[model samples]
Each structure stands twice: as C-alpha cells, then as structure tokens.
Target: MHWTIPLTEPSLGAEEVDAVVRVLQRGWLTTGPVTEEFETAFARKMRVKHAIAVSNCTAALHLAHLLCGVSAGDEVICPDLSFVASAAAGRYNGATIRLAGVVSQDDLTISPKAIESLLTHRTKAIVVMHYAGFPCRMEEILAIARRNGLRVIEDCAHAPFAWTRIGHQAEFAGAIGDVGCFSFFGNKNMTTGEGGMLTTNDDDMARRARLLRSHGMTVPSFDRHKGHASGYDVVEVGYNYRLDEIRSAIGLCQLAKIDQLNEGRRQVSAWYREALQGLEEIQVPFLDRPLEQSSCHLMPVLVHGSYPEIKQQLANSGVQVSQHYQPISSFTAFGSGAAHSPFGPWCLLSLPLSPQMSREQVRYVTDCLREVLAQKQLV
Candidate 1:
C-alpha cells in the first residue's frame, strides 16, 4: 500500500544534488577532503573541539564507549525507551547493558533519578538518548554523572541541532556530554544517506577516536594524498568505520540547511498539536518541556488501547505510521521481559512528520486518526 502521507521523507534539494555531483566529478572518493570539511563544519556547529565522521551513529556510539574506557565487567546505563543502539554500543565494548526507566508517560526520556538508582560501582558510563529530538534533562543528568564519577555519552541521533540551557549558557545536545554521537540516516532531521559523527571536547579522546575510526593509522589517507605524510603505521587496533566522500558531501549540504528543515518539522508538530487537541484517546508527549529548542525529529502519540488496529486503519486510509521503538528489554537477546516503565513495546505511534509535509497533509492524518478512533469507540 502506497502511503498518501509517509512517516518521514528526507528534505533533499538542488544543493544536495550539486554537492554529490561535485564529489563524483572530483573522482577521489572514500574519507577525503569532503569528509574533512564536513567534520569541521559539524564540529564548529556543535561548538565542540572535534567531530569524527563514521559509517553510522552505531559506530560513533561503539567508538565513544571504547574511548570512555568501558570494558568487560563494567556496566553502562541507558534508557529503555531508545533505539537498541544506545544499549548495544556498550555491549559492543564488553560492558553489561543495564536498563534505566523513562521519566513518565508525558516525557519518554530517561529519568535522571532512575539513572542514579541504577548506578553501581561497575557503572562506567550513562548513555542518554534525546528521544524525538527533545533535549534530555542534561543539567541534572550531568550532576548525577559527576557525583558518581561516570562518563556520559549522548545518543543524539534525533537531535542534530537541538539545544538546552544549563544555567545562563546554552549547549547543543551532542556537545553537552563527554561524547556525543549522531546519525545522518535517511529518516533523520538531516541525511547523508548513511553516516554518523562523534563529538567531544577532550583532546586525547579526539585524537584516539580519529585514529580508531580508520584502522588506527598514524596518518589518514587524505593526509598522505596531500603529501603531508609519507607513510602510515598502525598504532592500535581499530575498525573500518570511515564515512565516504559522497556521503560527506551530502552531510555538508544538509548541515547548511538543518535549521530550516528543523523549523519546518516544528511547524508541522504545532499543526499536529492544534488539530489533535481535545482528543481524549490520544496523548501527545513533550508538549510542555522547557527546552531552548528541539530538532523535532518525530511526532509520536500514545493511542490509549488502540495500537495495531489503529495502525492498520491509518494504513488503509493511505497514511503511514511507525512505532518509534520497542523497549530494549523486550528483545529476546536482551531478555524478553517488560520494561520497567509503562510506556513499553508497541504502545506508542509515530505519526507522519517531515519537512516536506504540509499543514493540509497533517490535518488529513488527524482526520483519518479521528475516524479510526471513532470506529473503534476509543474516543
């Protein structure tokens, strides 16, 4: 079934097209000048000392855990309400993945108090996911980490440009933690087709991450190409998680227009709130959070007791909806048990949200949802 309104669509235009064309015409691909430029631009935007581009956000997370000294016998705390990558990255580094509960039904982000309760001697880091591009309660979370001597790695896949205030200063989402990981997958606020970036303020960690991102080489291929270095030596064991020049080109273009794209998403979210207001069956989360700004990557609603049926009904009406995630603990590999929180697997619905969507399309989706709920007598 073709969706009249899809869950998300990348905001691509002539700038992205031209950037890709330029990279292709240059003939040199792989991690080269374009990738370096993209990393530089991203680093500047986040106000971080370094931004290391990688294959995807998962790679960024894995590398961050390693840099943070998470290893065997160590435990990492992550929200149950996020993509599995948040927890799985710690597991990749031989750390035990401990689950942390969300704040509440109204705010699907990790609770700082829950994180504090879960911390033990073995806890090495806390991985915080900014669900739906809403900034997590970082000020409180940071205080917790400081008191416990644990590192913090932000899973900022949904929050490319989102910010929150700490006292009188504002900080970007990815830059707020010790290490921030981002995704540029097709459905994100910005797209590089498939790419990721890691941001950090520590000089030594940045150097280590740069080396680890490309086979732990002393010199990168691009540097060698420019004759800045004659040969390279492997200093440490690392993975081949480098982002190519083509995707880097796309990232640079997307970064330039990210604010505009995010604003469009915000407008659509506003339209959703106004149109869906007074519908008792649907609960919109994060309407009252006091963030300086959000990237608005998704628009999710909790449909009281009407999930798969409502989903199918919307599909039949030519609208596409998605579940943002099933709690990490619900997976068989992680032990198929319910998450500690009430907002567990399959209860939430992510509506169509994208920069390309218009107010008319949003209204149409709400109308379809209202009809579906009435048919089921859910409203």
Candidate 2:
C-alpha cells in the first residue's frame, strides 16, 4: 500500500546530487580525500578531536567496543528500548549484555538509576542511546559511570546535533562520552544512503579506531592514493568498515544543512504537540525536559490501549506509521520475557516526521489520527 504520508523522507536537494556527481567524476570512490574531508567537517561540527567514518552506526559501535576492551565474559549495560545494535556491538566483542530499564513512563530514555542498579564488578561499559534524539540524563549517567570506572559509548544515531548542559557548559551528545557513534542511514535526520561516524576526544582511542576500521593496516587507501605510502602492514586483525567517497560527499552536503533540517523537524514536532493536546489516551514523551536540546528525529506517542488496531486504522487511511523498537529483551534470540524498562514496547507509536514534510502534511496526518481515535471511541 502506498502511504499518503510516509514515516520519513530524506531532505536531499540539488546540492547532494551535485556532490555525488562530482565524487563519481573524480573516480576516487573508496575512502579517499573526500571521506577525510567529511570526517574533518563532522568532527568540527561535533566538537570532538577525531571523527572516523565507517560503513554504519553498528560498525562504529563495534569498533568502539573493541577499542574500549569489551572482552568475553565482560558485562555491558544497555537500555532495553534501543535498537539491537546497542547490545549487538558488545556481543560482537564476546561480552554479556545486561539490559537496563528506561527512566519512567514520561521519559523514554535509559535511567541513570537503572544503570546503577545493573552495575557489577564485571560491568566494563555502558551503551546509552539518545532515543528519538532526546538527550539522556547525561550528567547523572556520567557521574555514575565515573564512580564505577565504566566507559560510556553514546549511541547517537538518532541525535546528530542534540546537546545538554553540564553545569554552565553545553556539550554535544556524541562528544560527551568516551566514544560516540552516529548513523547517516536514509531514515535518520540526515542521509548518506548508508554511513556512520565514530567520534572521540581520546587520542589513543581515536588512533586505535582508525586502525581497526580498516584491516588493522598501518596505512589507509587514501594515504596510498596520495602517494604517502607505497605499501602497508596489517598491525592487527581488523574489519573493513570504511565509508566510501560518494557517501562522504553526500554526508558533507547533509552536514551543511543538518541544523536547518533539524529546525524543520522541531517545527513539525511542535505542531504535533499542539494538535495532539487534550487526547486523554495519548501521552507525549520529553515534554517536561527543558534543559536538553533534542534533534527531534522522531515523534513517538504512547497510546494507552488498542495500539495494533489503532496502527492498522492509521495505515488503512494511507498514513505510514512505525514503531521505534521492540524491547531488546523480548527477541527470541535474547529469550522471550518482559522488558526491563517501564516503557513497554507495544505502547509507542512513531508518527510521520521528516524535514521534507510540509505543514499541510503534518496537519493532515494529525487530522486523520484524531479522526481514527475518535471513531474508535465511538465503537
């Protein structure tokens, strides 16, 4: 079925097309000068010392876990509501996953107190997802991590430029932790078709990430292309997770307009909040958090009951909706059980939101949703 209002659309314009064309014409398609430039620009925008481009956010997380020394038998605490990548990264390094719960019904982010409760002597790292681009309680989470001597890997795939205040200073989401992983998939706030970046301020960690991203090579393909090195050596076993020049060029273009795109999403979300008001059965997340600046990547509403029926009704009306995630603990591979989080997986509904969507579309979607819920009440 064709959706009258889809979940998201990438805000790609002439600039992105032209950038990709230029990269194609240059013929240096692999990780080359353009990729380097993209990494530099991303690092500057993120206010981090180094940014390493990779194939996707999952690869970035895998590299981060590897660099952070998440070995077999080590426990990594993660939120139950996040994408599986958050836990899978640790599992890739042979670590055991200890799932933590979200804050409460109103806030969907991972709770610092929940993380503290799950902490043990074997806990080596905490993978925190900034769910729906809302910044987590970072100061509290950071303090907890510090007290326990645990590394913090921020899964910032949903939050490109989201930030929070630590005292009087503002800190970007990806830059605040020991390592930050970002995604540029088609549905994200920005798009490179498929790509990701790993960021960190620690020099040693950054260097190791760069080395591990490519086959633990002493030299990168770009360096060889530039005649900086004639040969290379495999310093250690690594994975091929490099982002290509075409995607890099597209990423650069997207980075230039990210703020404008995010602001557009904010406007759409504001419209949603106002239009959704006084709906007794629906609850909006992150309405009370004033200090954190969200990237507004998604607009997820919690429905009290009959979620599946409501979702199908919306789909029948030619509106495409989505669920942000199923609880990681509920998966068959992970074993069927209740999620550790207070926010159950079945209640949340992701509405249509994108920078490319117009105000008329937003109004139409909300109008249809309101009509659907009202009709359901009548029955």
Candidate 3:
C-alpha cells in the first residue's frame, strides 16, 4: 500500500551511515561516549542544562512524570487531541488522566482555559504537547502551572527546534517546561531510528532521570567498563531505558543537520499554505502564527466535506494522507468518557509532508484535493 509520496520520510544519508559504521568499529556498542556526546549536543542545541538520552520518547515521558511527582491518585491534565503517549506516560505512573479541549479549530493546541477548568486538588502535573511542531500557548500554560503549583511536562515529540515567546525572550519548546520529553523516531524532525531525550533545568531532577533511565545504578555499566567505577549499587527502582552508541552516533549526524532540514520543512509548509490558499472548502490551522517559529513537522488541513471520501480519492490519485490523531476518548482503553477536544478530529487531514518535498509535489496534492472537492459537489 505504498503511495507515490509517503506521509513522511527521514532525511538519512552517507553521514548517518558513516556515523553508524564508526560506532560499530569502536566496539563499545552500549550507551557510552557517543551517547554522552549526543546528549550534550542536544542539550546545547535546546539550551537546557541536562539532556538524558533514553530508549524512546515514552521512556522520556515516563521519566518526566516520575520526576514531577505524578503518582497514583494524582491526575495529569493533557490535550485530548494529542497522541496517546501524552496521557499514557502519566498512566504508567498510575495517575489518572484529565482530557482538556483545544483552543479552536484554527489553533488546535490545548486550551489553557480548559486546563484551568479541569484542575482539582488531586492534579499533579500538566502535560502540554506542541502539536505539529507548532509551539503551544506556552506563556499562558506556564502561568497556569505556576498559579496551581503543578509541574509542566512538555511533550516535544512534534517540536524539536520550535520555540515560544516568553516575555521578551524566545524560549525553545523543550526548555520552557519543568521537564521536556523529545522523540527521535524515524518520522520526527530528527531521526535516531528509535530514541528519546529528557531535558530539565533542575539539577536534582536531571540526576534522578539519568539514574532512573538505566536501572538506578550508582554507576552506569559504561563507567564500570571504563574503570571509572569499581562496582555499582541499585539505589532506586528503575527501568532499562538506555539509548545505545549506534543510535547516538546517528543522532549526532542528524542533530548536525537539523536546522537546515527544519528550514526545508518550513519552506515546504509555506508552499502548501500558498497552494491551498483561497480554497474555502479547506482550512489550515496555525496560519496566523509565523512559520519561522515552527519546525513544521506536519501539514494538517481541515477538510470541510466528506473527509473519508476525499481521503480515499487522494489515495486513488497516488497521494498519501493521515490524521494527526483521533480523540483519546474514542479508544476503548480510555472509554471512561472524558471531555474531548472539539477540533473535529474526523475532518482533520494530514497531507504528505517532508523536507524532501518539492513545490511541484505540493501543487499536485492541492490540485488533487480541489478536483476531489469539485467532483464531490456534482455528486
């Protein structure tokens, strides 16, 4: 079921291959110097004090929940429009989830007002996801957290270099919250095959996350193998969520080119915006926001009529499309019937997007969309 253009593609090249080969040649396959280097580079890029590389984004989110004191009986408030992992991480710690609606159809981020309304004495933390690499209304969200004495965990899976205005300063997505969790999956702005990074400014939380990422050992196996530590002790209960050297090396290569790659994405998004403009049948979210502030991980459009039919038509035309997410409440696992976002997920359409995309490709997609809509009107 391969379309002419896939939903997304990672920009991997000879540099990544060389990086992986170098790691294999070094023979220290587990998390070691390369992982440390990746973490340092990522932290420096995001302007964070500490970055703990993990097995995946879920591990980073779980660690963030633990570090923020989200435990059983406590509630974690997050957007209903986000991927399930946004809430699942809190559920991992036995915390209940409170779903908050989005701001509007034009800005599908979590509503700070909705978050404020859902607060309870049992609320422990607020999880905000920057949808499609666009910064959430972080200034307001952070103010809500500060007012409620709740920790803020940013789900930066969709936003790597994206930033928000905080007062006169521009703070990077992962650096604004109490703890930021990032994904480096194959489709993300950057790729490490499967890996994640947890960032924090708090020294104590950073130490705890690093310790807990690798089974709470007093000393990591890498250190012991290098004669830096004679022995080790397990001080706290933790999981085996360490990123290996191979992925770290690849991550380094990806990190090096992320700025340029994201710029390409921004350009592609702009092309889509221009191509789709004046098509009253479709609406693009976040149009009011400047493109430079977003990593533009996705090009989601709100289809006005018969979304399923249009999606199928696009498929027939050799175009690929996707949905950012379905309401978390729609899943049987989360059927406890929480308030859902009113952004009409059923009509949300994600057109193919990648830094590799060309203006011609975008125009083709838009043309297909217009033709499909015209055909539907006659039916």
Candidate 4:
C-alpha cells in the first residue's frame, strides 16, 4: 500500500517540545525574554537590524503599514498573485490597494512593469510579495518605487531567508526592502504554530512597530515591571498583535534548525525538478536557475493545458497536492463584486516538499504525480 504525503509540513522536533515545557515552567507565558531572544536571533539570521515578533504575518504587515503612514484614500501597489495578507495589510490601514502584474505562470512573482502602471500621486507604498518563497524582480521593483518616491515593504510570508539573484550575485530576500514581514505558521518551514515577524533597518519604524504590536501601549510589558509600576498607558491606537512567549520559545529552537531544514527542502525540490523536467504538461522554471543559495519555502509548479484534473488525480493517489494560494484580489474582501478576474485568481500549485520528509518519500510523491500525468497523457 502507498503512504500519504503533506504538501508543506513544518520541520519540527524534540527541541520544540522541550522549549514549550521550559516556557510553561517560567510561568510568565506572555511576550518576554524568549520572545526578545527570538527577535534578536531572527534579526541576525535575516541580516536585518530590528525584528518585531507578532501574532502572525498579517499583523506584522498590518503594523508595518500602520507605521509607514498609510491612511484612508492612500494607495498601495501590490502583486495580484500574493497571499491575501499582502493586500490585507493595506486594507487594514484603510488604504486603497491596486494589484497589478505578477510573472505570468512562472512562479507568479510581481513584475515591476505591472506595478509601475498602477502608481499615482496617491501611491504611498509598494508591497512586493516573494511568491512561493521565490523572490520577485527586486532591482526593477525598487527602481520603480524610487522613481515614484514610494516606501517598499517586502511580503516575505513565503520567502524567509530565500535570496533574490540579480546579475551575477544574490541578496537575502527580506533584507533588500525598507521593511520585511515573515510568517511562522504551522505550515511554514519553521513554525510556532501561528506567529510572525516584522524586520526593518529604520529605527523609527522599529519603535513604532514595537509599540503598535502590543496595544500601542505606553510601554512594553517587558520594561513595564522594571519601573515597579503596573499601570500603563496607550499612546496610539494599536492592535493586540504581540507574539507570546510560548510561541517564541518554540520559535527559538526551530530557528536554530531553519537552515538545515531549508537545505532538506531544497533537496526535495531538486528531486522533483529532475523527475518533472521535460514534461510538457508542467514547467518548473526556478529549478533551471541556481538552487544552491535559495531557500525552498514553497514548491509551486505551473500547470499546463487542462491540468486541473492532475490535482484531483494526485489526491486520489493519496498524495495531498494543493495550490499555494487563490491570489489576493480573488477574495471578495479585496476583489470585484463576485466574479474575480483570472489575472489574479488562477493557476499555481504547491507540491509536497518538506524537510522532515525523506528523500525516498519525496521521490515517491513525485512518482505519484508523474504517474498521473502520464496516465492523462499530459506529458
């Protein structure tokens, strides 16, 4: 009998359980020392200055927008083929969002040309998502934003340490833009069940984010007790987006193994590339390029003609296949009345590739997909 495989699973281990138990023993299970340690380690690992932990990536992006001076009637340019939180970041700030071009069927990353067309005088910020852990064309996107005098916020919900290569070199994904946001949900490479991080080099943005993430309070609970005072004050309107110690505790241990985990995912991705290459029914573009310096946060494949059936076929074979997203603008909260356009609502499927999965298991999952495609004469 064949076994089942998950699309994306967290590479967790005993460290997570041990950390959780330690945090529980500490008794002050709210945001505290462990959260601070995780933030610092995250900042160092991502090569950023400041890291603000939050409830999730949505809150991180939302807080980033709020601190970036986004307001009602202001416009933010975003990629159409992104996770909903990317655009929702602007919506939470009461900003009008305009989603434009993403690399068509080739990893679905946003294109600079598509975004440049949407910019106007009201365009305050440009949120670029590293779709499926693949970095967008940052140099071109940054050039466009600079020409328009717009703030750049990287939606790194997909790509954490994934690097973007331009010309002969590469740089970490989140480190390129003004601010970067990351998700640590259970499905991510490293997870704390549900947590997020906001990273920035700007001191003021960091201060505001620190405050905004915790009720926009007059003080961080960490520093509150040092003054021997229990009463606190609110300086600005903020949300309860703080990451708790319990989650951070788990994150700290997971962070240590992130690179190894990413390497494992990369190996799985390479196996899929080798197995799925030369197939007419699908294409894996990112694979043809360099994988040595990349982090495989997701393994989204471009489905070719009449390929939707492959997803069902693979599922029936006990291989749990799924799409990375349905695009941000496809949802009613951000889309047209009801019938959202395919430009932002169409194809892109994530293949099973997790660090915890063995090489043999990875090959089997791709074998199932390969078998289905062959049966359907898709190749």
TM-score of each: 0.96, 0.96, 0.97, 0.92
- Best candidate per lDDT, number? 3
Task: Write one digit per residue (lDDT tens) for candidate 3, span 312-358.
Answer: 89999999898878878766677556543355433888999999899
What are the per-residue Cα lDDT tens digits for candidate 2 across 1-379? 6889999988989999999999888888999889999999999988899999999999999999998889999999998888988989999989989888889877889999889889999999999999999988999999998998999999999999999998889999999989999999999998898999999999999999989989999999878888999999999899999999999999999999999999988888888888888888688888886523889999998875556787898999889998878789887656476543245443788999997787888889988988887886788
- What lDDT score goes with residue 30 in model 2? 94
Greater-lDDT candidate between 1 and 3: 3
Model 4, poorest ten-residue lDDT window?
337-346
Clashing residue pairs in all predictions, respectively, total 0, 0, 0, 0
TM-score quality measure for candidate 4? 0.92
How much does each candidate deviate from the true structure in C-alpha RMSD? 1.8, 1.7, 1.6, 2.7
> Ranking under lDDT, best-scoring first?
3, 1, 2, 4
- lDDT score, candidate 4: 0.80
Clashes of 2: 0
Q: Please give, for residues 1-379, the per-residue lDDT of candidate 1 as tens digits.
A: 5789989988898998898999999998999989989999999988999999999999999999999999999999999888988999999888988888789888888999899899899999999999999989999999999998999999999999999998899899998999999999989999998999999999999999999999999999888888899999999999999999999999998999998898898889989999999988888999896433889998989986546787898999999998878789888777566544255432699999998788999999999988987887744
Candidate 4 clash total?
0
